[model samples]
Target: MLALAALPLGVRVTVLEPDEHAPARLCARHLHAPYTDPAALNELAACDAVTLEFENVPVEALAALQDRVPVRPGGALLARSKHRAHEKRALQGAGATTAPFEAIEADTDLPGALARVGGRGILKTSELGYDGKGQARVNSDAELRAAWENLGRVPCVLEGLVSFEREVSLAVARTPAGQVAFGPLVENVHRDGILRSSVFPAQVPDGTEARARELARAVADAWALEGLITLEFFQLPGGDLIVNEVAPRVHNSGHLTQDGGGVSQFEAQVRAVLNLPLSDWRPLHPTAMVNVVGVDGPDGSPLTPDWAAIDALDGTRVHLYHKAHRHGRKVGHVNLVAPDPGTLRARLASLEPLIP
Candidate 1:
């Protein structure tokens, strides 16, 4: 998607991905090599600017290219985000309210950590955890110990679960000069810790939405960010919003902008990284996005989606990643737009069975 967005701007992209069959290979210049390969890093250094789409990028790799090209969002932010403990601390440091949590780095810390977080919480790896991976739920000492052992006993953060009405996310784009663009707050639904769908405009109070943007911008400003940063929030019944996690790049929740008939998040990333003028972040329609996760059904049967059937539905557009579908893999997404919320909800319900 980034490659498609950059093409009109005449910005060529060279992708360094270890997966030879990566869908990006179809559009961008494919450098089929490991991310840290010295040769690949040198090749990337020749580009006008470098931006990361995922958080697990090796910070040292970005450091290697710093002297030769611009790395948007910078290596500093990446380092902080790579570790969950550091991320939570940074959020609180910026005066954002996040879930109550404690960091655990050893066996003895488990008991105290559990007690600190109300004796029950999620144990997540401090690093390399996403899409419901590298974490476990625990309610007692035995469960915590077993989960920790199951997780390989790595550096982890125990987050105390809190009650909230719904989940929402806000995307913020920042330039090197400190200018910012904020995307509308979008309500999100997650199944098994992976994003299932998202709806635009959030159905949130104007002030609550404004507060979300304020928190996102504050973190971006504090981090001296350059590029897109998305902050996920849990909206409480009392209308308070607490930070859940932060992604220092364009996020899955903001994918609706791709078909929203305005400046998409991909373009925003390009503009922010290149120090170009940003565009308006408003969308033309009320949009909802449902991820096309793998092609498997609940009974473990292959159920590849019929494009014709999908096309038969109104207000729907398909975006395929052109990758092999494995269980729980996000191969692509479908965007649905409606004249109003009532129609959108009905469309989503009808389209649910079509997704696998």
Candidate 2:
């Protein structure tokens, strides 16, 4: 849905999606087909350039499109970000700090790997995991075996848990011509591994924000990145930051940019991919973006909340995805802007009951 912001920039969008009812299709022309279908590839090749909404796209499909049309951030970056092991290495190669991790290809290796991470760690699948899915927190040998079995005994990475003060993210945009822009650092709150809310102008020690900006710029330069890139970080108690994960597309944490920052992340991506000049992004106000997760009905459809209550709130803008709600799905979000962080938090609290 955020991608719709690019439309006003005078760019026509053609979304190639398998799901006819995907939210973004509501605002743009959509070609319904699987991403890996040859016919779909042919259709995508007609576009001037292509960018992805998410990073888990099939590498084979991207590789096929690369020869036919430009795919921003390219297949190499996509492949690297899709797998946990590869992403860790990429961050290290970029000279970014990351948690200690080891690969576990078999259930038997779980015990030894756990010991290496100090007997407690997060075991994540090497591929296809998001929002706390395909992950397990194991502290014992029995839990380790269960985690391995739960993940289908696939290749996995065991990461030592770090004692961090907070979780924050930086959204950076770069153009083919090497121009770069960054959205404000955002402090994220998560529940069950799914992002619950993003608070802009994150409350951190002095110099933390500058460090994050520097890190983000370095990562963007290292990847020769084009379009939007978000880097998640863990702020240690001592005020140091470590790379947590990288998302090579518009990020949920950046949704606040729509109202707080002078330009939205989506528009920045459009500018980057089109090789247009980026705006001087600045925060217009303190903002809070809260995700509206869905609840399953008895028939397994999404049960929506009272829109009137949400719309009645002052300084709040509600965006609902045109999708049938399924349990735990991100059906929409509410972006609230205020004069300061305290006002933003209060506004968020008032609207909490309206979100499923």
Q: Which candidate leads the pack in lDDT?
A: 1
- Model 1 CA deviation exceeding 4 Å by range: 295-301
Q: Clash pairs of candidate 2? A: 302-325
Which sections of candidate 2 miss by over 4 Å?
A: 280-282, 297-303
lDDT of 1 by residue, 1-356 (tens): 88888989989898988998989888999999888899999999988889988888888888888778989988989999889999999999998998889888898787677778887899999999999999998988788889889999899999998899999998899988878988878999999878999998678765898788789889998888989888999999867999999998889998998886788888888898998998548567888899988757678786787678878899999999998868888999999888888888898888877886
The predictions' CA RMSDs to the true structure, in order, are: 1.3, 1.8
RMSD of 1: 1.3
Query: Could you tell me which 10 consecutive residues in candidate 1 have the lowest summed lDDT?
Result: 278-287
lDDT (tens digit, per residue) of candidate 2 on 1-356: 54587778777888878887766677788788888989878888998888988877788889999778888878888888888889899889988899989888965676577778877889999998898889999898788888888889999998988889999998888888899888788999999899999987798888888898898888888888988788999999867999999998889988877877588888888888888998646468998898988777788767777788888888888777777766787878899898988988888888777876
Using alpha carbons, what is the TM-score of model 1?
Answer: 0.97
Q: In angstroms, give how far residue 135 of model 2 lies from its true place.
A: 0.8
